[model samples]
Target: MKRRHFIGAAVASAAALGAPMLRAQGRPRVVVVGGGAGGATVARYLAKDSAGALDVVLVEPNVVYSSCFFSNLTLADLRSPESLEHGYDRLGAFGITLVHDRATGVDRARREVTLGAGGVLAYDKLVLAPGIDFVPGSVTGWSEADDEIFPHAYRGGAQVALLRAQLGAMRPGGTFALVAPPNPYRCPPGPYERVSMVACLLSRINPTAKVLVLDPKPSFSKQALFEDGWARHYPGVVEWIGPDAGGAAVEVRPGVGEIVVAGAVLRVDVANIIPAQKAGAIADAAGLTEGGWVPVEPLALATKADPAVHVLGDAAAQGDMPKSGFSANSQAKVVANAIRAELTGSRAFPPRYANTCWSAIAPGDGVKVGATYSAGEGKIAAGAGFISQAGEAAELRAATYAESFAWYDAISEDIFG
Candidate 1:
């Protein structure tokens, strides 16, 4: 939205592992796609644990990554976009080759990963953490033509810059509208936290301006905490329309920047819409879908449809866990460990996931829910996790939630660093 965003400084590759030390070259090459949380974690663990025995290559188009973990706080302006910036120098240091390229398709039976550069990477095992992409039709008025006005900003980099620019330029008494996607999308509490953050930013400069949320679902992740924080901090400045209130729009009009819901029409100065999603194209091409998402074995995240392939992050069909950066980080670690046992002549055993999602309604204010899961028959089920709950203790809300910020740091360090 601004003419362009500043790209991050490229990092120098520092070797993390070597072939002879690893004893892994001829053993089996494990290639990971998507250098976000999941891909980064898997690559680091495999390279680190294999001790140079395994061939690890991480393919991601961007060198620097912006985590969606605290994106809501970023939207609110409590955190600078720089706080979320990360790169792959750390991955290189860990001895994983970092390749900057777009992945084209997979020669599944051939065990070859086709790249945009026209080179094919052979892998004994392939893990995909490429993340989710939006479906254009989910929001009626949204289309390529509207890209200039509203940005989903769900991904990273310039997209974050565009949203920041729009909010900065808005005049006093302006209205900001956020079009929330259907349930089971990335970062369930993300939409609400984003609008909350925007409201926090606006409350100071343009006190009269309002932030509205058009949520497709009747409820969302961490609803109680978000509402309480909003009521105390933003009050009338923020409003939400759930499905009962006709927040679920049937269509979008990009030309007019209008969203239609149950025969009602609404237009706004800024709109951010995230649609329903599936795994990235690479996942679908590799036979990862039972439906839109890649169904996998719970503990290892190996493709249930194909044992040789592993799926992690938003791309994998881990139904119970909210597809947050933390979930991907946790899942990747388990997958990495599992891959080690299988290849290193040890049995790593089955896997389960530990996922936690935290949201910031305002600076210094946070709420989070987490759980430990176990493998169920066909899917992963709640084992020792809280599904959903109400109530907000200022102490647990503040102290425990402050740890959410730490999570971003931990995950990044584990992956790239």
Candidate 2:
């Protein structure tokens, strides 16, 4: 059968079996809040694998999602922001109801989700995957109002464009300062990749330019690999300061484009401030957060507050998994299978997860770190992992870069298609 026709038939069959039409027929409803990597993947797999036995609804505020995974490439002009934007048409074709609205509240007592659009969705199971929100007041003199002066660009979309434009408008021989977030934030390797991309761009436009990274943590993901690449690819252009060296004690003055580090003020051309982050606000509003992020059972991704409600992705404090798109996608599959087994008597398998984070240090130079995980005593535990070694062949580095591009395409398709 033709692909289009097959999808059409699938949608028709799914709608017929949906809860709205088949509630009297006893179809179980699964309402997913936050249609990102985790939420979208769970909704898709539940609806597709259930073969019209489940009613799945996805709630997301954005009509098009610009992935944070490859967004750093936008700064280096390696990829367009438009290329990272994906729509839900393919997901809709699989018979999931796509509601483009924000979730205002989740009522655990009633198992209902309140929508900003003035409707309540009741579900047999609720999944929350709202991603992360920056902690207020974490960065002095930096807020949403000052985003133009100090772009976070961590959430992708317009922020990415804003940072790219700021990089382009930077004066020659000026310094680009980056304030890295604390540990346990989304995408551990993200800030370093941004530094590399900014360094790459600055080298072409302004060889005499400098990039300063003020990090709260002493070490970062793939530290040796990134440091080696920085020296080899953009020698003397990038400088990193750890907390012991006064990177932690810092304040920013957006009004004057200056950053004060260790009691020394330095004027900067562009400042990218990534403050500490926690689970999204909705998760807090639902009373799911005890210490800023929701704690979940590793195997089922079920919230400790309520088992009927599952939390995945960055919001859930699942051990050993970095808050990356790949980790979220992996966790979503486990949750989907568990939910299916509960509703449809399907066999539930043991949960296993994996994640790989790829970083582009320079053009044609890429590196990665990844691990396989299993549910352990009280948390998810890392099993085996690998990282790119130092002093690799140039061709091998190029191949790694190529592999990253391929992974991007494949993962995006896996989530949205």
Candidate 3:
């Protein structure tokens, strides 16, 4: 639900999960952290291409990972966690070492990675791709433990289960609150889409149940599409609280199951709080994130803080781009390619990025966004991007949504099928 809980639960354990102690031979060691979209992608690509030349060690707590990208569709009963859960069984074929441990620290000077349980793992080049983390004291009266009472579902899987259970237990006409964090958090359009899907779920069982969006910002991605879809589909079932409407959640109390916003006190049956974030702590422990997120030489996707370390995914501070799974996965390619070139002493290729975010508006209809990126002086810049048009044609919308499924499958295939 909350990003850190997923990290702690999914990636915090090592030896308990039965990771191999053996290191592949005759290859440069490559260590990867957090095996969601980015870390898994990097590990698969590197191990596949490099094989014996590069030993890819993936540090992740979960043997199977469920992606947040399509988890909202699960609310519509269009998909399941099974649709997103993936394992790196093929990594062995590519000579990748799978470690079920969270990276606790990095030895930049020694070029080694320290895991929570597995101790020190030597790496010729380390790849850190752990996903987002909630900012400490993000909302007043709400610390990490409040997570037990409110499930964010920003990080997918078990959090989805918790939120679903809460939804199931609530009264038919109960309120579901979607508390959106400030800008630059993971999955820019995630909060709105989540509310829409939750509305879809509630509308089926309880037409009177309402989905309330308490947004920090004045604007959101695909607002027109979401508004029209809500109006035409859910009608009075969904309401959005924007800045003008004073809809920001300034504080939350799990003990009371309430959120204090602008000037209103709205009690909710189910609360999803997407908090502000930073790069994973391993980056901070290693002094990689200077201005909060890791600042990188956009061209190489290499952390200027430590050249031996490359930070990709939600952790890397790429300005303007939303901290998203797609962004991280796209950035993984650039970093992986750069790492390949660096290890092989080949001509470095100019980096390019591809990102696509898909949000399920209904069971069969979805809105999508895409973009291309190139490295600039200090930060990565968007070269080209597109968003799905409002009030989509049914055939095209269905096709586009289907393409989202294809994209997930293809991306995972490229990463770790």
Candidates 1 and 3 compared: the better one by TM-score is 3
- Higher-scoring candidate on lDDT, 1 or 2: 2
How high is each candidate's TM-score? 0.90, 0.95, 0.91
**Off by more than 4 A, model 1:** 1-25, 347-350, 386-395
Q: Taking the tens digit of each residue's C-alpha lDDT, what string does model 1 give over 109-197? A: 77777777555667778999999977757777676456667888888767767887888888778888888888668888788778778
lDDT of 2 by residue, 212-239 (tens): 9999998999999999999998999999
In candidate 3, which residue pairs clash? 11-61, 313-328
- lDDT for 8 in candidate 2 is 32
Backbone N/Cα/C clashes per model: 19, 0, 2
Candidate 3 TM-score, true structure as reference: 0.91
Scored by lDDT, model 3 comes in at 0.77
Ranking by TM-score: 2, 3, 1
Pairs in clash, predicted candidate 2: none
Local accuracy of candidate 3 as per-residue lDDT tens digits, 45-94? 77666645666778887778888877877766677778888887776566
Top candidate, metric lDDT: 2
